[model samples]
Target: MRAHPAVGDCLLALSLLFVDLLVLLSQARQHHGQPWYVALPLDVAMVAPVAFRRKYPQVTAYVILVLSVPHSALQLGIGSATASCVALYTMVVYVGRRQAALYVVAQLAVAVLQMWARWAPGITLIIIVLIFALCWVLGEFVGARQAYHAEVEARLHLLETERDQAGRIAVAEERGRIARELHDVVAHAVSVIVVQADGASYALRSDPAVAERAVRTISDTGRQALAELRRLLQVLRNEEVTREPRIPQPTAESLEDLAGRVRAAGVPVELSIEGEMTGLPAGVSLGVYRIVQESLTNTLKHAGPGARAQVRVRRAENLVDVEIVDDGAGKARALVPAPDLPGGNGLIGMRERAHLFGGILQAGPCPGGGWRVHATFPVRLDP
Candidate 1:
């Protein structure tokens, strides 16, 4: 009823039984040796096993082969031929080629014995062999097609799994990049604001003019920080399509601007450049800028009061180099924590930026009582 194998096999068996019944009716008219009632039961037994050929191919084929003998002995027409052929095809497709080959040999042997005993014609034997051969060929072709489809389905599933893994990896990389950007931007801006705020509070009644400049520096730094934050948030919100003006990312050339800001925040900074810092690839240039910015922020935060920082940039034919050095002396100011500690996020970010671009960064205490940060990068990156 559901169009299943058993139902289909049962239908096929019924058709074979109908053909057998017609053959028996004709034999009875001729007054054959065995009565129609006697051969009918053998025909039913032989043909019924064909219905379970697919479920139990080996057993069904052997049962059909054995029952085919008595059915043929009674001169039952077409029932042995039709049922054996169907069983052989099922054996080839479901069981295996070698077992089917043996089964076919056995079927041929039985047919030969039956014909030899009856002294049948050579043409009938040839016809029986040809029919069984056709069934084997059809089984081979269909089995090959089913195997090919199964392989294709397996390959498609593997590709889909790999594609999903790649998408997840890309997402993780994007999140890491955003986290590094936020750390660099927020850390530098907050350091400058805190320094200016402290200076403003101290100079407020001692020197109103100095205090006024420091307060103005705090306001400017906060505004700049807020602007950069909005840009980051806009990117997160996927709003780049809007017509709002966008600030260009800072690059190697912005080191002078960065130094000037630190100078304005009550520390002296000397910036020096000996290379053509232009036309750098965007990622490399940005990495350079961030490394320097983080290093300078550490200087402002950790290098005590009278500490002066010097930044030097050099460009070789195929490389760019940056170095920041500062004396730890704060001129009797409160002692602050040292810079470039092993576990500091600022130091780690700088190193990760350098490593990302196939470069190296080293930061530690100078030989002559100061802190030094140095980084080097190649001009061209691997594709």
Candidate 2:
């Protein structure tokens, strides 16, 4: 029988006490022994502690086993001693296996001595053995259930940890992409603004009209910068639908417009092209446009007043070469290292953009005291 405290203990205690007293009365009548009154109180004493089997299982089991010997010796009811079996079974099922086994051995010894003292019947001995077996089986079943629950809990915990790790990895990847976009937008816009501001400042006293043109370029560049920034921030905030209502991006064909703006700022720029430039990929074309834009802006800032810049683009079978050279005595002045000038993040940004498309960029003073920027990009016009 399963050993549980709620229903099992109460039922077992009541049944055992009633059966023991009834059996004791029948035996006393047959042998002319003591009356039912005396055995009834003793039987109640034996079954009373069974109720506490779950709360203090080992202690209750031991007490019931010890008391069973004297109750059986006194020829009390048969069911009075059976209540101990229920308590012992409760101990084995609830307590640990080692303690349960020790309890079983102690109960067996008490049973043997009681049976010998009164020469108990065969049926009574068989009942005791069955109780011991039942207790062992119940103990094993409960232990298996506990182990299964633990295994399930451990697997659940492992899956939750993996889920959290994946979420962190996703967040890190998103942050990296956002950082690259911001770098591209800010670096290009800031480079253009710095160049136009410098040109306007230089032309203020001698050529007020040229200075006014440079200031207009500054305002246009600022507006473009704000638009790009808004696009990036909208993406960050997950508002992509609203940003779709904004202006489209500038492409390779827009290079002439870019060159016109630089010329309007009072810089003289000569543009030349070679090979079939019509079929370059969008990414490569955008890269070329940005490189040319940044190079001309740098010329305006560092090449001094009245400097001349040449922009050349040559396309071959698998590669494109771009060169921006300025012929001016301003190279020495640009190299003088003005502490107030912005740091070299613009140059770093250009190099990073080139490297991303599998290209290389070189910028420095030429042997004849001019500044030259040369870049090479691999191009795939089609898929």
Candidate 3:
């Protein structure tokens, strides 16, 4: 059979029942000689509240106190007074300190009056007071430990919530970073491909040799763009990073090859290098390459017929500078003085790339009928 939750408590309360029973049977002459039935109910009332002392300590104490009056006045057993002492102990352990203090004071005052009425000796009264004081101190110690455990649990819950919040924020930031990388890779390649396809279509009948070269350039640019796209998409997989060999990103050395492809697309391109390309940080190299690549792509799309482009790169002791100018049909599309608010994805992506590496971009229309993009960055030794 399953034991009940209150079984142990009932057994304790039953022990006190025997104490009052023994008083009634062996010490009947000490009272006014009341019968067993008359005194039985009074004894039961006193110990009944003991079973609920821990659940309702203050209520139990008050109930025991009220019951004691008739028990004491009618010359019944002292069970009610004894039960109140157990209530006092529970009060300190479970109730607030102020309530415990109030009950304790009330108990002591009644105890003193009882001792004085009985004319008990000073030593006996002192012993009773000492025993109650010791129980009170023990209850206070248990209360302290209970409060400490509760505080620790509260702090642990708060820390767990903060940890989950930080993880979500990190995931959101990684997603944004991936979006920017995809835009830079796909936008630049698709622009070059579109321009080359147009040139190939027009030159197919009149200039067969030029058309063939544009087709080959388109094929090569498409393959390179595909490889870069695969690298960016790898971040989404759950596999370990080492599962695939890493691909090197494009740097400043790739600019000449890039300009060659743009020239192959029918635009006149002139590339110039003003400073040493060595000793630049990896991020700076990548940022510079993307900036130049994107600016040239924009010129191919926006610059009108008979347009020519120039790319200039200069490295200094503290910074690296870049300039791209195109003399195309500019007045038709107000490419200069780009709106303070970003005009398109191309403009927004360019600014994001520059800002990622502590750089600044200036883009606007040139008075000579074209658009120009200028950017500069601190040549960081370490990323």
CA lDDT of each prediction against the hidden true structure: 0.84, 0.74, 0.80
Per-residue lDDT of model 1, residues 1-383, tens digit only: 54586898899999999998898888788877577668889888979998888789999999999998988787787888788888888888888999999999999999999999999999999999899989999989878887898899999999999999999998788777777888988998999999998988999999999999998988888888888777777666656727577777889988888888889986798888987778888988999889888878888888887888988888887788989988864332222245445647777878888888889888877756667889998885324
Q: Estimate each model's TM-score.
A: 0.78, 0.53, 0.76
Which candidate, 2 or 3, has the higher lDDT? 3
Off by over 4 Å in 1: 1-83, 116-119, 238-247, 329-342, 381-383
Backbone clashes in model 3, listed as residue pairs: 336-364, 336-365, 337-364
By TM-score, the better pick of 1 and 2 is 1
- Writing each residue's lDDT as its tens digit, candidate 2 over 246-313 gives 65555556677777767766678888878766778776777777778777877766777788888988
Best by TM-score: 1
lDDT of 3 at 248: 83
Candidate number achieving the greatest lDDT relative to the actual structure: 1
lDDT, candidate 1, residue 204? Answer: 100
Please count the clashing residue pairs in each candidate, in the order shown: 1, 1, 3
Which ten-residue region of model 1 has the weakest summed lDDT? Answer: 330-339
* Each candidate: RMSD: 4.8, 8.1, 4.7
